[model samples]
Target chain A: MTRFGRMWVMTGLLLGLAMPAGPARAQEHAPAAAAQAGGHEIDIQHHIGDSHEIEIPFVGIYELPRFAPIHVGGLVIDLSPTKHLVFMLLSALIVALVFVLSARSIAGAQARGRPATGFAGAMEATTLWIRQEVILPTIGPHGDKFVPYLLTLFFFILAMNLFGLVPGGATATGNITVTAALAIIAFLVIEVTGMRTLGPKGYLGTIFYRPHGLPGGPGGAVLKVVLLAVLTPIELIGKLAKPFALAVRLFANMTSGHVLVLALIGLTFLFQSYTVGLGASVLATGVLLLELFVAFLQAYVFTLLTSVFIGLMREAH
Target chain B: MVHALMLALQEEHTSGPLTVEGGLMLWTVFIFILLLLVLKRFAWPAILGAVEAREQALEQQLAEAERSRTEAAALLAEHKRLVADAKGQAHGIIVDARQLAEKERAAAMEKTKQEQQEFLARARREIDVERDRAIADLRREAVDLSLAAASKLIGERVGTDTDRKLVMDYLATLDGGR
Candidate 1:
């Protein structure tokens, strides 16, 4: 067999052997933790709500909360250091690094065959794929201009989503506030691109233009105006609904996947049975794999739909 | 008690909402706009220029390939025409050589037949001359024998005078009778 074929075969065999052994090991070691627990079980804190109480050390305080709020000019801000913000900044840095590296690669013409490498190649492939497959096809000519924004949105959401999967990690996307911010950005881009391409008058016309076919006559113009007026609230609501939907969809999917994995793992503690723990362990592993797929899928879906919305706004009709 | 608990929860929920009220939104908007501007100004033009350059290069290569293909096809056609012309010339030369050989052979046969006829005529003329000479010699011999027999009966050999006299007398008698 060819080298690649043999490598694939070896990989498949390794996975086949490893998959069963993992569950078996979990099954074998199930009751040891329960025996150690005796009457008192070890409880790990999983705080879902916003407010969390924490104990401070060294300063001889009776009680202390995990987080505090600071007010600045009537604005109350949470002073707690959250990992989500770190992940966001990291994502931005990663994007900057990718662009800088790719730019450097092309800067010197003498460097042949050095387009992109490793992470850079992956980032470029993703950007180019989205531009060619999703954006350009939907947005038509001059669609390449929006590639950076689209790529940024995709990687940002992806990094945030994957960051939540790490141990003790909180999902920024799970918070409605973060998702709403992203959606609002998309909303702004769409409106701005539309206005820039079609002018303000054309933009308003896009919202109001209706094909003529109704039961009324000259009165129909008034009816059209009335209908448009009535539909204005609905259109505005729809615009808000888009970001809300984006936020909720990502937050719900990520939260639910994590919850399921946690629940499966929790089952072993609730019931001190080896077979049940083994089954749950296997199921949780499978769910983890699925979560990986969901991470990428949600990111792609968000970026693809956002680009589509932008394209729709940019369209003439 | 329930009221106090509700108030506590409400305070908890409402405490931080105002602190970052417009600040976060403003920052997000500012950062996003900055990102868009920077990307548009710096990164976008370079990326697009590279893509366009690559596309143009590909198009140029394709055009060159097509031109070369056309040139090759034309060359092949020219070569085929030349080969066909050469084949036709070769065929014509073979035909001309065959025709020339046939004409030369016919002329040679005609010349050879003329020479053979001349040789046969010369041989027949020589044979006729030889036969006439032999006949004259035979006639002279007979006359000599007749003269010898007559001299033997007269018991004397005939001399040259006698022979001439006999020939004259014979001739004179023939003229008188005439």
Candidate 2:
């Protein structure tokens, strides 16, 4: 293995061990044991309730806040920072590293053996499959052009989702901010691709022009205009709704999976039974596996849908 | 089913509204946009171009292989044709050799028959000449015998003139008959 490959493997191993075991150990030891062991618990007191936080030496702080939030205009809004951003960055880095390594393998003049292997190969196969099977088919002639965007989105979302499943890791996608940002990016790409394909005037005109099958000229034009005006907003609303939908879909999936696992785990604590605890732990672990699948699934779905939406937008009316 | 899933998701997120600070939201948007632009410019084009180049290279290799196969087939066919022609020429040579041998044998037989006929004719001519000489000798011997007998028949003191007259008479009669 190259030095880079060895480093990634080490990093993956460290992350694999650190992410789950650290949280589990903290949960087991309790505040008293942790203090006895000379471990300090950084107490992050918030508006809702007091929660225990953990701090890594070089890494940022970690905490899980309560469900309650600050209300504005009858809307309860969450303002606390979740571990979601850290996971998001980590996932992005992982994806970038994998692609960079794969790209390097291809760029090298003398590449031996299989082109795809380890994490890099797996990622390449997935991206190629999506580009060929999903994006190109949906997008048509220029479909290949959008491959990078779709691939990046898929990996980025996937990494974040997987990270969330780790015990101490938070779901960045669960936060509206992260999902909304991703959605906006999709929205921009779709619009830009559409604008580039259909000139700006043509794109705008599509919103107002309705083809007429009926015969009274002025009346037809008027009726068409009125119908188009109504449809335009609806179309616009649908466009807005897509990214919102994407964000919510991913956020909800990650959050629900976490919540379910947490609830299952909490049952043992509530009942104070060793058998129940063990059973719940087993169930939670199974759910965690399912969560892993969902992480990848949601990421794929989000990227695929975005590509499809962009493809549709780029089409001639 | 999709609707139900969406509804469930909504219900789960309904617990709190996430209010991101405007500045952070703006910054997030800017960073994401920058990321997309940078990716589009730098990473994406390179990656896509590489993939395309790889595909083209594979296609070119396939075409080249096909061309080589066709050329090989053509060469094989030419070789086979040349071999067939050589075989045909060999057959022709064998046929020509047999015909020439037959002609030469006929000429030799004709020459041998002519020589034998010439020898037979020469031998026949020599036998005819020898037979003629023998006939002449026999005739001469007969004539001598006749003359002696005649002389003995006549007495010793008999007039030669009378015997000569007889012989002359015989000669005259022979001449008159001729």
Q: Model-by-model lDDT, in order?
A: 0.60, 0.61
- List, in order, the clash count of every candidate structure: 6, 1
Candidate 1 Cα misplacement greater than 4 A, ranges: A1-81, A105-110, A212-240, A268-278, B1-27, B30-59, B114-178
- All candidates: DockQ: 0.08, 0.11
User: Which candidate leads in TM-score?
Assistant: 1
Tens digits of lDDT, candidate 1, A169-268:
4455655556667888888788889889999997876667654576577888788888888776776776677777886787678667755654564465
Q: Tens-digit lDDT track for model 2 on A227-312? A: 88888887778768888898788767866766565455445444545676567666766776777788888988998799788878
Give one digit per residue, the lDDT tens place, for model 1 in B1-178.
Answer: 2332233235434323112324334444554566556655555555545655666778999999999999999999999999999999999999999999999999999999999999999999888898768765664565577677878888788757769467556655665675
lDDT: worst 10-residue window of model 2 chain A: A42-51
Candidate 2 deviant stretches above 4 angstroms = A1-82, A97-134, A209-234, B1-24, B37-57, B106-178
The DockQ value obtained for model 1 is 0.08
Docking class of 2: incorrect
